[model samples]
Target chain A: MGGYGEVHYTNPTGPGTPPVASLARFVVYLAHSFDDRLALRSELEVEDAKVEGGAAGGEVSLEQAYLDYRLAERLTLRTGLVLPPIGIINETHEPPSFNGVERPGFDHDVIPTTWRELGVGVVGTVPGKVGLAYRVYLVNGIRAEGFSGDQGIRGGRQEGQDASFANPSFTGRLEWAQPGWKVGASFWYGGTADTNSAVGRGAFAAPVTLLSADARYERGPLALRGVVANVSVSDAQAINAAYGQSVGSRIAGGYLEAAYKLLQTLSAFARHERYDTQADVPVGVTRDRSLARRITTLGVTYKPTWNTAFKGDYQLVRNAAGAGEHQVLSLGVGYQF
Target chain B: MQQPAHPAAPPAKVAASIARLFGPGARVDTVSVDTTDVLRVSRADSLLGFAAVGNVLGKDQPITFLVAIDPADRLMDVDILVYREPYGGEVAYEPWRRQFRGKTAADSVRVGKEIRSISGATISVHAVTLGVKRLLAVLTAWHRSGAIR
Candidate 1:
């Protein structure tokens, strides 16, 4: 659970943007093992405080539903709805597992954390000092019609609905890890336009590709991490003119975070995040500075147990437009079993 | 969904690890842990050490690993014979595994302290640390109670 209060600083003396408290999300993870070689895992989530099942309500969706089969010591087969092996949190996010009250903006706007799709894949590791892991999958692709000027591909994610397969996508990740250090790279490439759908009546397949990389280091009481991500769209000019939306040809951003444990159960962290959902537009389209966001967050997390945490953070969000900068104070508590 | 229950290291891998720890010519015995046989590495019937393999949850899935303890109850070495998770393979690295050497129950044998933590592999690091702690505790008990000599 999470709640935050925000005040716009664009006009310091004037009335600020409203402050609000919200229960951000509730999620449940389930897994069942059939034996030593096969298992099933799933995550069901509720966004916002409630879901009325009527006109005005929150949303409920499945984040992961997959089965894993161990084919060998280093190789495994996985099928069903699975989070693409991208970014740091897309596959490992269980609330208590992270440091901030909310996820990094780069993950939300660029990499799209919790981005799962119906697919099948192989995941394996090569052991030693130069430990390595790799994943490759064939999955359903996004829809261009859902792409927007403000959210970029955030809305384009089909989330494993009756997803189209006119042009399947491929997502892959590779990581190299050593004592106290890990570095990884991931990518997603596919066609978004449905050649058969009316929206693509006369347009070529609009291919969308995303590339990302991250690194982390932890030793003793200190931890450091950073991530960089960018999405490039082909045929954005025509697609924007046809859909009347300003989905940029490129959206990019990244973040860096550092944390130190003051005590066994208490830690202080600071993060800097920057992202521009509309970083680059088509030749004739205008860029919206507001779409480009940068924020510095300071926070502390208290963990009474390994799988539970209470967090509080203050975010100083800078407005690129220089019109509505704001500060947000947030608190949250989370647990996982 | 069929999951692996009590998934131990494969026989060939277990044998190879034992030979590596002891010598290639050392004698190996299979001692019974309830109904399951645990590997006992030795030379000419004199006990060199015991090889214990077990599984613990690493993030969402189980990580299977082996622990080798010398006669004095100190860890000789740790070898990740089989790891089922996707992200925490760092625990299998030789340098990271080497950190647990010579540690006993008297030591914390916990991550973020005695054992260095692996970034992005926190769960696996913690799990293995706890596993080593538990192994030491069991070995200490056996030594004190005369179950092991």
Candidate 2:
């Protein structure tokens, strides 16, 4: 399980700009294997600190539930809800996996992680000095009506709840790993429009295409990682007109991070990220410059054991629109058993 | 966590592996394998080495691995027999596991230092390191007590 909280300051030197505290998350991750060929994995998460049948501040969600079956030495079959292999953090964002109090903003805003879809796929590895892995799957399409200017198509994620099947998306990822270096690339192609003829929301032709690449390197006590991602929407004009929102035609972002382990169980790290959800707006639609943002984080982590971690970090946030700059301090703890 | 019913490695395969290590003509026997799946390997009337199979949780599931130690109490090899996790299968790759060869209790076998960390398999890396450490501790005690020769 992992728990995180942060204090945010909307304005640095302005009166009445008191810092805001948020209980970002508390999560439980679980996995059970019945045999070598079959297993079940799941996660339950709570956000915003509290929940009263979901009427209060916090929300409870089933983050993932999947079944896996080994088909061969190098291949496995998976079904049910699965996190798509994309950015560095999407599939392995356990709190201890990173140094920051919060996940990288580039992953949250542009890649829109914690992203899962009900799907079926196969994953495999080629055994060698230069290791190779590949995964491919199909899932329900996104919903265009849910796209927005600020959140981009993040809200369009149906999360497999009675997801529409008018169009299915295909996603694939390939990775190469070595003793000290790892690199990967992924692609997603799908339609966001799930309009019904009777409801007549709009023409169902908003196609979402994404490409991503990431790499990580570690030697001795130092670790380095970077990720670059971009998404392009076909028929963006139609999507904007249908939804009455300024969803951009293109979204892109990336981040670079470095960390040094100073002790057996202690480390210091830093990361810099830049993201623009509205990097390219639909024709005739004004772009929201505030959606273009950059952030830097400095943090430290103490892990008494490999399964647990205590973390603290400070962040500096800036926007391209010249909006109010802000700073944040956060703390967190995480454990797995 | 429910332990997988599957053997860390197939019995026939494990036997073949031991034979190949000692010599194609040598006879092999499984002295005892407990609930933790630690196997006691024997050759003829003397202890040739010790072997064990165990599971360590990776990102989301258990990774089944095998460890073989020579009679001199040094690691002979480590193999990832089954990797059930969806990603980070690099831990099972042969080159990565080869790093464990020749390691002994005197060595730290730490993940970030002596053992190289895998990018996506950070957890598995730590898990394997710790598992090997514990296994070495047990094997060293047995050796010192003259339980194996």
Best by DockQ: 2
Record all residue pairs in model 2 with backbone atoms less than 3 Å apart, i.e. clashing.
none
Off by over 4 Å in 2: A1-17, A53-56, A127-130, A196-204, B1-8, B19-23, B32-50, B55-62
Give lDDT tens digits, candidate 1, residues B35-115: 545567788768898777777766666677778888887889888887765456778888899998898878866677777
Candidate 2 C-alpha error for residue B136, in Å:
3.1
Question: Over the stretch B13-132, how does candidate 2's per-residue lDDT look in tens digits?
Answer: 666656655656554444442344444556567666777666665665656666778878899877676666665677777778888889888887877778888877877787777776
User: Worst ten-residue run, lDDT, model 1 chain B?
Assistant: B31-40
Across A1-337, the per-residue lDDT of candidate 1 in tens digits comes to 1111111112112265555555566777677767667877777877776688565866788888888898987788999998888889787676666788778877787887779999999988765425788899999888887788878887878788898777689999998877878899999998888763534542236888899999988878898999998899876777787788888899999999999999999999999999898888888789989888998989999999877888888888885896677777777777765
What is each candidate's DockQ, to 2 decimals? 0.55, 0.58
Q: Where's the lowest-lDDT run of ten residues in candidate 1 chain A? A: A1-10
Instruction: Compare the candidates by TM-score and give the number of the best one.
Output: 1
Error of 2 at A256 (Å): 0.7
